[model samples]
Target: ARWSPSGDRIAFVSNSGEGSEIYVYWNTSNTTSKLTQLENGPSSISWSPDGKHIAFTMKVNAKAPVIASMPAKPKGAKWAKPPRITDRLKHEADGAGYLKPGFNHIFVISSEGGTPRQITTGNFNHGGNISWSSDSKNLVYSGNRNENWEYDFRNSELYSSNINTKEITALTDRNGPDYASKVSPDGKHIAYLGYEDKVQTYQLTQLQLMKSNGENKKVLSNKLDRSINTAIWASDSKGMYISFDDKGKTKIAFIDLAGNISDIVENVGGTTLGRPYASGSFSVSNSGKIAYTYSRPDRPADIAMVTKKNKKPIVITAVNDDLINYRTMGEMEEVWYKSSVDGRDIQGWIVYPPNYDSNKKYPLLVENHGGPILNYGNRFSTEIQLYAAAGYIVFYPNPRGSTSYGEEFGNLLYNNYPGEDYNDVMDGVDTLLKRGVTSEDKLYVTGGSAGGIMTAWIIGKNSRFEAAVVAKPVMNWISKTLVADNYYGYANSRYPGQPWENFENYWKFSPISLVGNVETPTMVMVGMNDLRTPPSEAKQLYHALKLRKIETVLVEIPEASHGIASRPSNLITKVAHTLAWFEKFK
Candidate 1:
């Protein structure tokens, strides 16, 4: 959703009905109007400077119904289904399945309503970092136009298309991706984020500067060690402000044309509605006011704004207060301790049981986050709070390889994940025990995706935790790299070489390889329809543990994808089942 250039109207998309439609609301007239109807929703909406047209990316070449020859029966006829012919390497994706033979092309239509015009056409898809020139004559966006784009997911370049002539020109030529173009206020320069292609699992995205014509490119944030998210140019056009995660918190910073940097605000998060994971965004207006989703431990995201430094943000919305005010929430405290393995500082948070007493020891329930790249921060989390509410002390940590931290921390597990990271979690657990908060004999651990990988690895390494639940984990790295939807990119960037080239290394990292030492009663959970970390990974571990005489149970959520808690009912079920398993063991 975006406000028009003139600020007199707002343009947004709605998918409430059978199809997605674009609508515009007039502030003066106090009336709403539908601009256009689309077969599929478009993304990255860019309103022209003159407020005459809007540019967006939409999928082209809609597939026609597959026809089959069949003989009709008496009255009730049954026809054979048409066979699907697939020829793409990256054919299917989570949430969206079965990639059709089409491309995401840029299109433009009048603000009032008219026939949409196709601006760019090719085999490759174009989206993200879309912006219109101040003159409204051209629109710039980022896309991978290079050949073998599907194979090389990270090779994308910036391109600009003439609104009238429909001619497209490449703006940046580099091995790595350069995207998220934001035209400066004066329209003389473009600020975007990019990095050199080292083919490593992690790399810092440097904030770059280039002339309007895409010349004199220079990296304005070369000194910053963390990856820059996005930049919104200052009203003066002298420098730009960028948001990045450092350690366990998200901070907003400024980068000048001379490569100098400074911090603006800290604790800029709360966009992630589900878990207390790292996520947030901010937008700066031309008048120097900054609006962002503010995060806190007691509540979810609330709209807040700031106009000056060192001043408290004025929260303008109380969307969750109606329910939060009536609930008795648990207390969340920040924990900082050194990793037991290498003495690296690990940031974590512990939620005390509701109506807790310091003298009483509660059972510890350590929750591990997925991504292994994503980090948990000081935000409202339903799952963690629910655990604490059930008379259990919940612990979540941002170990090595967690983002919001600098590049060095995030790359700690580049090729050595589930290695020292296991030590980090154990150290966090030890810290809680030392603090006299949790009982040592009734420890429980659970995690999803990469977190699931760590949970399995932890149980294999040590039996301190009495019960374990690993959700959607990759028990065997060799099989995971071959069958996962993003095998090409994951296998190459995450590891040194192909599965056969680095067979020993792959085996060394697989949790199934160490299943012989398991003694803890473990439960394996996965979404039945998950493609990212397939259920087969869970079955392999379950079977391996069973063969070793280890008590194990497999819990598969039907009709669910990689995200098991995508629906409200599923979230309730996942929490209820996990808590039930822990109660049974207790």
Candidate 2:
């Protein structure tokens, strides 16, 4: 709770009934005054070098859901009034059933309470890492402003703008995404991560440096082909620190202006909870002191701080200390196996149930990750832990398209996903069975979104699983292409041609095509407002199962999105419902 610059006062966020407000606490006067009174929450407050104003992001009220015009009162003389037309979009939302109109944008306000001025405007959503230039006259951020913003997930470019006039200028124009840009301390250079674009997938993101005005761009880590997760400027601005994954381990490295790459630290833990994937985040102070979240196999993620002189790190957050007495947690162990389809080494993790006895057989739950492109690494995941706590052995693998394995390994399933990756998952399950960690009769499968599609596909191809829970799955490519959030991207990248041109390929990979072979009791769940992997996808699979008289049930989480378990209450319900479904089969 220390103030920056002169340190006369500490600036922090204060919560009230309406929302969170920024406040500055004067140490001498022992008084607090509000800096912002935004209706929505304010965060990432950065003080100006002159300490006159603070820059932060705030959510502004936007357009409300539109309601279709209702037919004039049915010419009925007895009707007192015509029924009001409620918004369909509101009714379709999860949890809240409808959304309160809001859009996130960057804003600046005085350190003392006053009217906050909006600095940027557009339909495109913008909020993530934000930083101020050395002169404190400009703001830098990353967001997508393409014409087709809804379907352009990979087109985010770094942008900078003058705070006074709000005149924006693009810093990088590339086919692939560029994000996490930070202006160097001296204000001459900026560092960020970028990669070449491939259809439907992303490559290993490398650290790049460019002048503040967007000239002389060059990749700093050309020799280090691994993806650079994040980059931060050093105190002197002569060099910058970066984090990347080597194999499955997270390493912190530094690169000087001359492009000399040196590993500053390695084995910095942070992937806790589920599998041991390379995941960690670090923030450096102006004094070169680094604070990071660190984790180990036996523990969850915790904050730690380190300095150059004192290489030894100190844990700041004690989340694990409170859970040490709990006996229901599982122990995650990294596992490696050769793919049956090919000799490629597949990496995954096995979570053994607490109080597990080798003599007794246990049920196994194969969980698929959402992003076929995103990796399921050794990061802390509450969803996986709850399953392990329920006496179920959980297996989460990176499959073929998962990141951190290199560009080639990640893009292996590019246009051919659910093909080789499917074999890789099944082979991993077989390997686990051979290890005697799971029984065939007690095996179950479940995943949401991309993983959901895989779960449905698995049951369609094989009846090995006793039961399956497919959450927010895609059943029809044609329908998905038309209705999904990123409809254009999803359809264009997965299929070589349009639906009419490549109907056979779409059907060949779709789970609905093989629904007739599904005999296992399946439970399908979807978020009512999920634009990505819309609920209609799950309904198709459920209706198909019902038509064939297969044991099936469809559960819709109202007011939720593809990320249905984002809320704590919803997470509990999701876990409870999934466990109940598996228990009924057991």
lDDT of 2 at 68: 62
Give the per-residue lDDT digits (tens) of candidate 2, residues 409-519: 877775575788899999999998998877788899999888998999899889999899999999988788767655556555666877778888877888899999999
**What are the Cα lDDT values of the candidates?**
0.86, 0.79
How many residue pairs clash in each candidate at the backbone level?
A: 3, 14
Estimate the lDDT of model 2: 0.79
Winning model by TM-score: 1
What TM-score number comes out for model 1? 0.95
- Per-residue lDDT tens digits of candidate 1, residues 281-368? 9998987788888888777888888754644788889998999999988899999999878888899999888789998889999999
When summed lDDT is taken over every stretch of 10 residues in candidate 2, the lowest stretch is 86-95
C-alpha RMSD of candidate 1: 2.3
Query: TM-scores, in order shown?
Result: 0.95, 0.84
- Which ranges in model 1 have alpha carbons more than 4 Å from their true place? 62-77
